[model samples]
Target chain A: MLHLVLFLVFGAICVAGAINLLVQSHPISSALSLVVVMASLAVEYLLLGAEFVAAVQVIVYAGAVMVLFVFVIMLLNAGVEERTKGSRVALILGIPGVLAGGLLVAWVLIERTGTATVGLGALPGFPKTIGNLLFHDFLLPFEVTSVLVLIAIMGAVVLASRPEPKNPEKES
Target chain B: MLSLPIFLVASVVKIVLVIFILLTAVAYTVWLERKVVGHMQNRWGPSRVGPFGLLQPLADGVKFLLKEDLTPPHVYRPLFIAAPMIAVICALTSISVIPFGTAIPVAGHIIPLQITDLNIGLLVILGVTSIGVYGVALAGWSSNSKYSLLGGLRASAQMVSYEICLGLSLVGVLIVSGSFSLQQIVESQRGYFWGFIPKWNIFYGCQFVAFFIYLMAAYAETNRIPFDLPEAETELVAGYHTEYSAMKFAMFFMAEYANMITVACLATILFLGGGNGPLFGPPLLRLILPTFYFVAKVFVFLFTYIWVRGTLPRFRYDQLMAFGWKFLFPLAIANLVVTALVVAYRS
Candidate 1:
């Protein structure tokens, strides 16, 4: 009963934070709301007994990545007044988006209920299990992910370094 | 019905006890710092509050409480208010995993000194401590002041760099111990090393190097002098807390001291035989002695912190980054390799 209450509370917070991120006028407020969403997800992960993953979520998403986002926002001087106004067209289209998301969640719940089983055995040492899965089963995907990250880093550097174009005559 | 209510009350009492101890320790740490720095600088400090200025922290607490809380005109009010609370929460939460003493029997119930003993206790500590950087960074950014923002940036960079080394240094200890559980690690250090020295991390050859790196990295990670460029009063003018006032400012101060104690305690547990000493008496006495020994070791580290603060000058910003990246990073890698080889050969 307590777990159910806590889960619902956390899930509500996560949804509320996500909605706030989308609706908020300020980019900084959106970033702060995103942090709340990330932290709620981390708590959910913790409740699921994936402590290491939860820790990584908090450390990486909340600590490193959010700080980087805030850093860029501050550096770019992206103030609340500069935020792009929300379009009515997007709000109109969001009805379908929400419907699709709700249907997907419902399907997942139904599938989980249909496949429910009891008496699952304990897995191996958690770190070892995760390590083995990463190295053995998903080795190619893991390496590919690294390559993707490297590409993203290089792209960021290139974008950050590109010089502003001078006049047309100077270009010629 | 009775059992549920009893459980709730018991847990509440436990939480209260833990908070009380943590707050008291943080308060006394300030007193310890003043006394230690005073003696180091050959000057009397805080001699007016109580006997030997023992109540100085209480006085400071009252002053902070009574001071007018100020919010800068251009500051982000919500984030500014949230930052210090986040800092204090993260600072105090890490203590949940720390085993302060052996379980004591109270009215036929064995109550552990720690609040919660998770299996992955060390990781929890690391996770919580890493999150603490956000508070400092957020405080600086939300203040809308150049100095505060710079301090926050410096703190974030310093924390991120040192955290890598700090985590890497602990990899050696974790490798040998074969567990992330703090209680298990302490229990594993029960035996002797070559018949004399305790089987602590510091006693091991390469582990000693790792311990030293961990110590240095932890000091930097916690933003202590001489690595405290973020909070350097000479330059940054109180750094991230520059725009904060009253109880909010006090929260940051408390968080810093609390984090210092947490790091000191972790060092004592990891490198110093963690609540383990030579058996010189009966079972009860033996158990009690180790806790005392652990506290004494923590005091030593805390004193070293103050001594270093009084003696060493702050590092230049560039020098700090260079030292962390160029020196400590490579040194930690070398220590890990050496430890792995030693462990392999021993096996």
Candidate 2:
């Protein structure tokens, strides 16, 4: 009963925060709302017995990644986002389209899973368990993901760097 | 066995007790800082209010409570309010997992000195405290001042950078202890090697480099002197908290000291054999001695924090970043690798 209550509360927070993220004009407010969403999702993860994943979600996503987003927004001094002037038709249809997409995904998920029940404290979330699974069962995918991340980092550095002037005094 | 309600009551009592003690400790730490720093500068420090300013924290608390609480017109009001609360709450929460001593059997109930224990206690602490970085960053950003903005940016960057080394340094301890539960780690450090030396990680397991990295990163993590560019008073005009006043400012102050205490506690648990000590006499002594040792180790670390604050000059922004990335990161990684190899070979 307690678990169910916690799940419902956090789930409500997640939905509320996500909606706020969409509605808020200021980037910092949106970013903070997204953090709230992520934190609520982390609680849901914890409720599902994925403690390590929950911790990782908070530490990496909510803490580091969202902080980066906030930093960029602050550095750029981004105010309220100006509404795009592209097409009224796209804007008018986008809301209903998004709602339909969400319903379809939920329908598909429910249909596929049938009456699958999630039991609390059943799934193991120990680091050792995760380590074993990653190393033995999903080693290739893990290694590939890591390599992809490394490449992306290198690409970013390359794309962002500028060539230094041969004659420093000439530039000055 | 106790009923569910009884267990719940016990947990609440424990939580309240810990919070009360931690808050008191944080307040005293502030008082200690002023006195120690003053004495170092060749001045009479706080000798007026109740001998060595013991009542100073009370006075400050009342003053903060009664002072004009200002929310600057230009500031982001919600975030400015939330940030310090988040910082303080996160800082206090990390202490939940620290076992002050082994379980004591009293009144037909086994009461562990810790509030609660999770299998992944250490990770929980790291997660909670990592969230604290957001508090400092948000505080600075929400203040709507150039000083606060710069301080916030520097704070976030420094915290993010040093966090890498801090986590890496703990890999050595985790590898040696072969557990993520802090209680289990402390248990693994019990007893002595060769009858004299304590079986702490620093000496027995030879993790001096890891300890050093952890210590330095911790100093940076808690935003203490030398690494406290986030609040460089002369340079940034009180940094991220420039616009904050009254209880809001007090919240940030308490949060910092609480973070320092948590770091000191972790260092003791990970490397100084946490609350593990010899008991030569009675049963009460046995129960008390462990906690005594734990407090002593933490006090020593806190003293070092203050001592360093009095001695070292603050690092320049560029210099702090360079040192954290160029020096501490690689050194921590090397120490972890060496420890891993040693542990593996021995096993």
Candidate 3:
């Protein structure tokens, strides 16, 4: 009963935070709301017994990535008065996207309606289980993920380093 | 029915006790910092309030309580209020997993000193400490002041950069210890090396490098001196908390000291043979002694923080980043590789 109450409260907070982001006028306010969403997701992960994943979510998303977003927005001088109306084209396109997303979520929920359930028992030996899975079964995907991150870093550097055309007078 | 109610009441009491201990410790840490720094600088500090200025923190608390809680004129008010609260919460939450002493048996029930002891305890501590950066970053940004924003940005970058080193350095310890559980790590370090010296992480030769890197990275992670560019008073004007006032400002101060102690305790556990001592006594005495040893080790680290604050000047912001990324990052990676090689070869 307590778990159900806590889960609902957290779920509500996450949904409210997302809505707050959408309706908020300022980019900074939206970003702060996003932090709230990320934090509650972390709490949900903790409740699901994925403590390491929960920590990673908090550290990487809330601590590092969200801060980067806020820093960039601040640097761009985004403020309350700088709010702009949504483009008509985006508004029209977003309706279909939102509808599709809702349908997909509903389908997932429907598919999992009568799954086998594990009774509450001792928590599994997480370190040994995860280590075995990561090293033996998921090694290829793990290595590929590292390669992908490396490529992303290289791509960022390339994009950032492209030189602008020098003015002839300034060059001299 | 009676047992259930009694268990509930006892758990509630334990939670309250843990919180009270943490709050009191934070209060005294401020006083300790002042007295330590004063002594280091050849001056008497806080001698007026009461008994070597022991009550100075209480006086400061009252002052903060009485002061007008001001939000900056044009800041994001909701986030501004939430930021310090988040900081204090994250700071306090990490202490819940730390086992201060062995369990005591009462009414045929054993109650642990810690509030919760998850299997992945060390990871939880790391995760909680990492999230603390948000409190500093958000506080800086929400204030809508340039100084605060700059402080926030610097702090975020500094913490994120050092966290990489901190996490990597601990990989060596985790690999050697073969577990993420803090209790297991302590249990593994029971014996001696070379027939005398304790078999701590520092005594393991290669792990010594990792230990140093961990210590340095921890110093940066906590925003202590030489890495205190985030709060560099001369340049950033109190950094992230520049625009904060009253209890909101006090929250940041409290978080800083609490983080210092947290990092210190982590260091004690990771490298110093946590709760281990040379002389072994009876079971009850042995448990109490190790707890004392752990606290004593933490005090040394805390004193070192004060000593560094007095003796060393803050690093330039660019220098700090370069040292963390260009020097410590590669150093930690190399240490990991070397430790792995040594372990493999020995086995």
Find the candidate with the highest DockQ and give its number: 2
* DockQ for candidate 2, C-alpha atoms: 0.72
lDDT of 2 at B30: 90
Clash pairs of candidate 2?
none
Per-prediction TM-score: 0.89, 0.96, 0.91
Fnat for model 3 comes to 0.59
Best by TM-score: 2
Instruction: Provide DockQ values for all models, in the order shown.
Output: 0.53, 0.72, 0.57
lDDT of 3 at B247: 95
Candidate 1 runs further than 4 Å off:
A81-94, A97-125, A136-140, A147-172, B1-10
Candidate 3 wrong stretches, greater than 4 Å: A81-97, A104-125, A162-172, B1-7, B279-284
Candidate 1 residue lDDT tens string, B245-298: 999999999899899989988888788878888768787786588778888999
Q: What is the C-alpha lDDT profile of model 1 across A40-132, one tens digit per residue?
A: 988877666566777778878887788778767766768675556679888899889999999998889879887653211222326556778
* TM-score winner, 1 or 3: 3
Put down candidate 2 lDDT per residue, B1-347, tens digits, no spaces. Answer: 66788678788988999999999999999999999999999987777889778999999899999999999999888898999999888999999998888788767788888998888888888888889998899999999999999999989988988988999999899999989888999999988889898889988555999999999999999999889999999989999889999999999998999999999999999999998888768888888888899999999999999999999999998899999999999998888878888988999
Lowest lDDT 10-mer window, candidate 1 chain A?
Answer: A116-125
Ranking by TM-score, best first? 2, 3, 1
The lowest-lDDT stretch of 10 consecutive residues in candidate 3 chain B is B1-10
